[model samples]
Target chain A: MPIIVNLDVMLARRKTASKDLAAAIGITAQNLSILKTGRARAIRFSTLAAICRELNCQPGDLLEYVSGPEPEAAEGGE
Target chain B: MDKIQRLSSRLRVLFLAGMVSVPVLHAVGWAFFERIMATPPLNFSSIFGLSWGEPPFMAGPATLAMKLLGFCSSMLPGAAAMYGFACLAGLFGRFGKGEMFSAATVRLLRRLGWAVLVAQGMQVLHGSLASLILTMGNPPGRHVVTIGLDSATLAETVTGVVIILASWVMDEARKLKEEQELVI
Candidate 1:
């Protein structure tokens, strides 16, 4: 399964550096990098809202869900 | 390990040794000096300078003893304060988070640092006064009588001050560094 973070697109659309985005969101640059790389454990709604407001994008523009193996295929024996 | 963690480990070892050694020393003294040879029975007042004597002045019955008792009672708080702070040291030493601890743990280390500083000051004052009274106030050449006070007081006061300051400064520096990291 691939859960995508389109943070790089959002950043490019707003012409903002990741460092500036991190400063705006009150998080470390390293943490912003983590989010941008889709390695964050989870995102807070407030953080997502801050990012959207700062980058002028909808939530869907920043995040996406991709298809994965079907449940039946995962279960094997079932 | 970080400095605080190292110091804490050292202190735990010292406290453990102290807990064992104190009772053993007392028991050994009792066996050798008091019970075994029985050399004229040790005078408790001579050892501690705590006289239960009668008072002069106002032709009263016994006021000096009261003053002595009050003095001893007053000293107890200093000792108690040291013990309380020592308990904090032990508690933190056992369970404290080091430099990698969370913000809450860092706050706890800060408070423990303050406690260490306060306790060191009190113990220094207490030990200095007590040693001065026991050593200089006693007769000039009483070697056996003044044997323990000077050594014990100097050792405790100096070590207490050093450990207290060392632990506090290390923790404070770490906290400031962490705060600065947050800023950057």
Candidate 2:
């Protein structure tokens, strides 16, 4: 729970729509939403690579680790 | 998937039939107890696995209390069978709808496993009670008490234990599948 997904921030910085990113990365919109919301248990390397290639960002730009417990609720997409 | 669906549908119907038939068969058997006991090969004692040194007979008259006790005794295993069949019907119905690994299916499997185990115990109880009821009308010296156990009972006990273990395994498998699905 200490690991946090910063996919929403990356999408915002790249000015990319979540649906468009999902389609480009060959994943469903719901799965993309799950990733953005930090609800996914883990992400596949292939999907990470596809997201990085499509968004022109590093994996580090999309993930972060916090020392404390996860927040009660995750703030997802716009 | 189609084959699984087809098989599940068929099994659901079969189990449903069993659920309905158990009580009906017990009712009919109780209704014609005397005649059925007289008949060979299909006699009540022969079918139910009870034996006595002398053939059991209904005492002076079939009183309401006697009939009630006999019916209740005979229906013990039948009731257990009905419970088991109902659980199986529900489990197969879920499978037919493609919910094989769902929690409801696992719950029904667990119930069915316990039902089988309970039914085996009920069979032993029924044998003892039926023997007592059938001989209750005889002279004090003629009363009988019989307890019967055969290889079939052992097989059934093993089968029930196996089913319970299978349900536990399936529950763990469901949890693993749910965790895997959460991964992207």
Candidate 3:
């Protein structure tokens, strides 16, 4: 995915634990881990809003768009 | 969900019974072939829609060999039915465990579909073979060869194709569910 999730960086900057953020955002710890590791297919707007509210940050601060070949395409080319 | 599980459990048991009974019933029918033909009400000729011809009264090697061959050929359809029933039992077992959209369930459903088609095809083949075997004891030039197709067989073929298509659609649904679960 070209779109990267910077949830770990935001959590660290806000001095928030992943478990506490998950509980506050009304999601499971595994789901929060999925978001942090960029394994999620897509995040719901409500969940994004909840995460932003919990960390006191903007959506842009949590998500970053980097230009590069897709991981699958890169693997296939090799 | 609980209701689905309960219903699935009951259906699983029913399919398991069918899986066990199919072959046993075929075996019993073959073992008492002459007696059943002698009895009007219990005659398989009416059930299978084929003339069983005159049963051999005296024991002969040729007649016994033909009967044995018929019995073995008859087991083809029974075995196919048993496989279909077993697949249904496994599919319902998964449903009972609340894995309704799992890949294993879809695979079992697909297998059941193929089994149904194979069973129907085997039935057609068995019918012709059985007719020849039953008439093998007749005088020369008096032998009978029969091939039959009824509406029931056609309906079963359509049902099998529909099941295979439904399993394909279920596979797509399973993929979508997996993707949805991955979304936070």
Candidate 4:
């Protein structure tokens, strides 16, 4: 499954450092990393709004649909 | 029964037995010791001096009933909570299913972490009360037992906090690693 964070792209487009982006978004750089890498299982609406506003991008820019594991192979392998 | 089920049952039985026996033994011992103390000319002072303190609590009459009930009410819940947590961890171990290093578990673990911090707050509250009671030089009634109760409660709380914090740290690291992998 390709889980796209779009953070690196967003940083490139805006010409913003990760540290500055994080500071502008009022979140710790570490938390920004958590979001950028798709390690987060869920994100708060407020945080999502904040990220969108700071990055000057829509929510779709931050998230991507990815194929999850194939169910038959997963069950059989398990 | 499966092996895990059998073991868990046995453990539960053993836990109950210990809980029943220890307090009963203590109560009986207290009674016997008090009886010996009541008898006159029992000048075996040196041998029993180690136990010499305020009048030993007796296990008879209405007073004893109240004391025993009060003691059990104060102490048993704390022991039960510890035992409950142990049983939970054990059950999880048996299934080969641990609290996964996942976001949900992390949140739950954080709650448990906060509980531990709250327990420490409780200890502080208890210590302040104990100090006040001591300085006031009031007769030791419920106040003395309160300090002892707080100590018992805090001990369990500390254990819970440690377990919660350990789990939280592990989960946090796991989350970070997973994030890194996504980046790669």
Fnat of all models, as shown: 0.00, 0.81, 0.90, 0.05
In candidate 2, residue B171 scores what lDDT? Answer: 97
Model 4: residues >4 Å from true position, as ranges? A1-78, B1-64, B79-87, B90-95, B104-160, B180-184
Residue B20, candidate 1: alpha-carbon lDDT: 54
Interface RMSD of the candidates, in order: 12.9, 6.8, 6.5, 9.1
How high is the TM-score of chain A in each model?
Answer: 0.82, 0.85, 0.87, 0.75
Q: Which candidate is the best by lDDT?
A: 3
Off by over 4 Å in 1: A68-78, B1-184
User: Candidate 2 DockQ category?
Assistant: acceptable
Poorly placed runs, candidate 3 (over 4 Å): A69-78, B38-63
lDDT of 4 by residue, A1-78 (tens): 344667778888989898898887787888778767666545667777877888799979977778876333322110
Docking class of 3: medium
Over B110-139, each residue of candidate 1 has an lDDT whose tens digit, in order, gives 554554445444444433333333333234
Q: Would you list the clashing residue pairs of candidate 1?
A: none
The true-versus-predicted C-alpha distance at residue B95 of model 4, in Å, is 7.0
- Give the Cα error of residue B84 in candidate 2, in Å: 0.8
Point out the higher-scoring one by lDDT: 1 or 2.
2
**Cα lDDT of model 4 by residue, B78-119, tens digit:** 334344444444433433333345665455455555555554
Predicted chain B of candidate 1, TM-score versus the true chain B = 0.35
Error at A46, model 4, angstroms: 36
Specify the poorest-scoring 10-residue window by lDDT in model 3 chain B.
Answer: B53-62
Ranking by TM-score: 2, 3, 1, 4
